[model samples]
Target: MQSLGLDVLFKGTNFLRLLEGLWVSVRISLISVVISILLGLVAGVLMTSKNIVLKAAFRVYLEIVRIMPQMVLLFIVYFGTTRVFGWNLDAEASAVIVFVFWGVAEMGDLVRGALISIPKIQYESAEALGLTKQQTYLYVILPQTVRRLIPLSINLVTRMIKTTSLVLMIGIVEVLKVGQQIIEANRRTSPNAAFGVFAVVFLLYFLICWPVSRLAGYLEKRWAA
Candidate 1:
């Protein structure tokens, strides 16, 4: 059997470079997720409010995000901003902005659904107990909403991590970008370089995401019980 010479991955600092790139992806996803969750929580709670204008504004934001393809959003932020506004945004910053926009919309909708899923009786019961609106949310409604939101939110986290691959189009040197570089460098000498590098990228993503998915399932089952 002809050896595929997968050793190229381990050659010199190749593996370390991949790790550094993976760190960039992870860092962007993590920070964006944090910001998304906070913003989503607020937008979601506001979505359930009785005020038509407030709800209508957030509804439009949600619709825009849902309708726009993330890649298009990335381009608009990274390239369009530079052309139109001369903003001089870096690739990583543009990636963060796009992902945070996507994440906030998705997470907000998830939160809205979770909050609305609670029966009206729950709210009435809180009122019957003479709980203030804030107290009701703090002590009763939010806890249940959180349990419902957790599993879905974790899934979003995985989605954001995977989607960070799109950042490469704007020249962020994340894992996929690193893999491309490795494959290009070895294109002549190692015919199997693309296969080997992409396989490693697949495994790295699975290694990062699979645990989060499993935890979501466990929590779902536990909450259901």
Candidate 2:
């Protein structure tokens, strides 16, 4: 263990700190995901409207999100906004804001796709049966949209969790940051601390995301049938 520097994790409270740091990352992602889902639902519905100008605006927004790197977004929200707007946003809060901004666009796009995928025949059939538009959506469209959206949105959660590592760049002290701290603190005694620390960090990430990915897959398979 000393040869490989895995012992660094066993020393003092290093492992516990890593766990706590991971929770920070997870907590931020969870908050962002919830807010993103709520706002994205509204944005998705708006995107589907017949207003050409509205659709065009959403298209531009989506493209901008797709093109902008999350790291850049983090800097803009954490550094630029804090200085420009004088809002005094802390690192963790800034991380959540950037993630929610990014996630909302992704979730909105997924919702738009799911909503549009429903066959027009279903709408026509509901109308033929004397169903009002509201009733048709509540009964026919929403059920299917929820099914499709759930799996996709769950997958997005994993992405957001993994992406929260970027928050460390803004000084959030998340898992990766904790690992780096461990490696640096033990560098003289454990020359290979970096390897073991980062390897364990990777494992921790896998442990969290693997189950979520599997769940998404299971739902997608079960609901597709």
Candidate 3:
């Protein structure tokens, strides 16, 4: 029995390999997202801090992260850091580190934007109602900020998933890397395998990212509505 392309996609071992690769991607993305959100929130708040030192520090951090390309960051962490420090770092670990660093900076900027976008009158009204600093943040400011933050954070998640592809450069056997290996292994038997395998890789990424994109859009609309 000849195997069709769909058969390759669904056969037991192939399915397991694909799932394993996907699980690695998901694990990295999920952990990176959590770290990014927590640290980003803190940095974001600091970016808006009244203290000049805090704000300036956060601004510098944001600028550096935003300007540094992810591939260069990965290389620095995985190669330069290890060579300079005499430390060993695996590709997966380095990928997660790079993504979290980038994601945190991006999320912090998004959060800073949201926080600043809040009207000053809202703060005044909170104070007029006898709300203390903590109380205002807890009751008045955070609720509104959360509504604005969710969709933006979803957008960040989508970006992180896509950037995981760059992990291949650092030798992580992610889906794209695995696909490349499969195509290379079959190059002699299937000369056109490169295009076919890469198409599958593209579709896999689209499937992963599209739903998150839709979710972000839906939240924005429902909130706006």
lDDT: which candidate is best? 2
lDDT (tens digit, per residue) of candidate 3 on 1-225: 122233344434665676577767777898999999988887787788899888788778888897999999999999998899978998888888999889888888888899999999999999999999999988988788878999999989988888787887888778877777676665666667667667777888889889998999998999984
Backbone clash pairs for candidate 1 read none
lDDT per model vs. reference:
0.90, 0.91, 0.82
Estimate the TM-score of every prediction. 0.95, 0.95, 0.91
Q: Per-residue lDDT for 58 in model 2?
A: 95
TM-score of 1: 0.95
TM-score of 2: 0.95
Off by over 4 Å in 2: none
Q: Give the CA lDDT, 0 to 100, for residue 118 in model 2.
A: 89
lDDT of 1: 0.90
Cα lDDT tens digits, model 2, 1-225, are: 677789999899999999999999889999999999999988887888999999999999999899999999999998899789888898888888888889999999998999999899999999999999999988998789889899989989999999998888888899999999999999999999888899999999999999989999999899887
The number of clashing residue pairs in each candidate reads 0, 0, 0
